[model samples]
Target: MQDKTPLTPRFSYKSDRLKPLRAFCQTVRLGSVSRAAEALFVSQPAITLQLQALEREMGVGLFERSGRRLTPTREGQLLYELAQPLVEGLDGLESVFKDKVAGLDAGELNIAANSSTILYLLPRIVEHFRAEHPDVRLTLHNAITADGTDLLRADAVDLAVGSMMDVPADLSYAPIYRFEPLLITPPDHPLATKTKLELADISRYGLILPPKRQITYRLVDLVFQQHRVPYTVALEVGGWEVIKQYVAMGMGVSIVSSICLTDADRGRLATRSLKEWFPSRSYGVIVRKGKYLSPQARAFVELIQPDLFTRRDYDDSGHSER
Candidate 1:
């Protein structure tokens, strides 16, 4: 038979307690016991007591006081660094677990979209849904063609918005818009002075374009390839906003979605249709094969779709059509 002895305290204080560790970390981060107390919604004396308890447990002074200012000592710095991550991680874990147990607050939603969709479509949708389902949190990730598709395949995102290119066999999409790309030139540029130009005529000047990874870039490439159009690309930007800025600077001419150009932008740049370019791009939503959607995600999709696909203005005869 083995004899059992009662466990004795190895340190001067209880090692299992988290309150002192948390208070010490908060004090160090905020730079004062009183400030930490205010932030934590505790009294100043309570903060002091926790810190003292922590220092006693460790058998070392954690902080040195200079008048009203409290600075961490060498040992305090080590302990502060060690305690901070654990305290924060535990707090986050607690919140997540508690929310899980409550059943009402469930999980998060992840959304991915291309640049144009994020800037043009998502804002109004997010705002409309957030009014009611404020408890659900959402993350939005934006990328170009293959990256966006990869995000969907990897299940990194619950929803995606992009040009309705070749969708994966398992996935589904709803076409939102069929939009023509407009040739853009800054108001001050010489090209802006021209009336009704063809793609061949515009190819003479330097062009600012999106990178080949983008769906718009792929469409542009297809157009040039089909017509055997030879052109000089002065810049290849990764983002649509950057392309717009470069065009606005009169650096080069660009082709972009006409809808992205607001009434305010009309004063800065000029847009004209290239009648020869017959191809139009389709933008739409992409969802996973068998994935279940949260209520917030479903609501967001509905709100944005109406704006993109279903807007109707009647004629004098009370008729509407594309």
Candidate 2:
């Protein structure tokens, strides 16, 4: 009689842990066990079993049934946030490994920034990054905060360099540079000569400001509303340079962040600190949560702040393998 060969299992204990987690992540993402099974090309029963096993291991009910679809429980949602990245990183381990080996030699790094940030903040950083990594293609999209946030959510840009006042939960804003708010006017403007300025004093004059849709307008309005002070906007300009020119041309007085001030600006415009009344503005790196910074992206971010994105939360996780 021929000796029967013992069959080896397809998945090991280590792989067993990985499979269930992948299954769980997929079901949570796709919102259907059958859809996840089809996407992963696993049998429906196997997907259900894997999900059941995961729920047992996690010691919690992972899903709340909504008709045929499923929504993750609170605990399950949190677990998905943490595990999705891990699963993605492990799945793309081969390509990420290859990218690391390839280095930043010839990859592209896309960054989003407003005109103000590109004009005032990123020039030196961009110059140095270009000098160090000449082979890496760098493109900066001119985007306002809302547009930049949209680009980040769409993964159209790797990161953004700007200031954020109210950071949303899905994005991370780390302000590396701080600048005091300033009141700017032509050197001959009345308020420019006042030794001490008050919010009421500033409110008396028409202000030239960015369009009301911008954060600066929102912040200015917020401060005014909080203090019960009334104000007016003489002009709704788009760019800082235009605002400065309008102020310089004696169109109106305005408030701006000191980040835009240069020696040339100081020569033409009288600037006074409004920090006492207004909060300081910050400029820094803004990245989407769970982003895996590419080599080129990482290098540029490090130039901005050596210790930036080193937090435990910014763990280097790559994109979905599937």
Candidate 3:
């Protein structure tokens, strides 16, 4: 019989070799080498070199440059789809394993949330999280939900905490709190005194709303259209505080999330619940589908909802291949 000794493996099992795979995954996800470099905390030239090495080894180009953009080629797309989860799984393995086996002694948890959420919603939750896991470094990226969603997709942030009206298929939202929509007006506005308020009545007055580009504006617009009520936007402002100030100054009436209404706010403005007219706004934790939550992230999520991770079918095994 002929000798049946196995030929040498093409790729060595050195851990550093996997760096190129990670570099390729991030570059494709962000669609630019520079952004990928920033995300990976490496130099742009380093990223480029890694991609070049990967292409040379695979014998196929992965990206096509068009102006400032890098579009993945067909081969690149196939590689990305196959490699992304594997890279993420490997990168997150240590954190996942330690989190499952040892108590939360140390880890980094990055979160994305808007200024409003950081201001109003997360203070207590953050305080508790800090007290519980003093060793875990927690970093919050201030971004609106729309921008936060993009950050989640890129794996830039571990998760997002905010309100989402339209959850993309690739992400999951678990609401921890629900706040009624409120019609905020100065104490003397005509609609404030009416014991029973109607949608048409509110539509009659000019409204101070968030910028038309925001999801809040879209929700407001859709509600008005559904009621066949013609509404006027008096001012397109950005922040809830600024909009509230505008309403108090009598610029226009506005609808806002009741979570923004505090005891201090009650003294300055009159709020009538719009639950009769509009759906309650929900605030929740948003995460990418199939993401492996680090122990620190899982701890914070559990603080929000005791069984949220389990209900979502998260893999809790310390050595899970997934």
Candidate with best TM-score: 2
Least lDDT summed over 10 consecutive residues: which range in candidate 2? 313-322
Better of 1 and 3 by TM-score: 3
Residue-by-residue lDDT tens digits, candidate 3, 1-322: 9989998545432348778888998787678999999988999998988898788778899999878888789999788767766787788878667776766887688999987888888898899999989998899999888999999997789889999888764567877899889999999988889977899999889999888767678889999999899999989988888898889889999999988777777767988988877889899888875577777787898887777656533556311122
Steric collisions counted per model: 0, 0, 0
Model 1 TM-score, 2 decimals: 0.60
Candidate 3 colliding pairs, count:
0
Q: What lDDT does each candidate get?
A: 0.70, 0.84, 0.83
* RMSD (CA, Å), each prediction: 16.3, 6.4, 5.3
Clashing pairs in 3: none
Per lDDT, the best of the predicted structures is 2
Off by over 4 Å in 1: 1-106, 306-322
Superposition error at 111 for model 3 (Å): 0.8
| Residue-level error in angstroms, candidate 1, position 45 | 64
Candidate 1 residue-wise lDDT, 1-322, digit = tens: 8768877556433555667777887787657988889877989998887887777778899898877888899999888656655665565566545644753344567888877777876777778767756777878897775787678755588678777667753456766777777888888776676776667888898889888767667777778878898888889887767788889887898888764777778788888776468456677777654334444455566676645324332122211121
Query: Which window of ten consecutive residues has the lowest lDDT sum in model 1?
Result: 313-322
Candidate 2 residue 162 Cα shift, in angstroms, is 0.9
What shift in Å separates residue 204 of candidate 1 from its native position after superposition?
0.5
TM-scores for candidates 1 onward, in order: 0.60, 0.77, 0.73
224-309 per-residue lDDT for model 2 (tens digits): 99999999999999999999999999999989998888888868999898888899999888886666778788889889887764
Which candidate order results from sorting by lDDT in descending order?
A: 2, 3, 1
The candidate with the higher TM-score, 1 or 2, is: 2
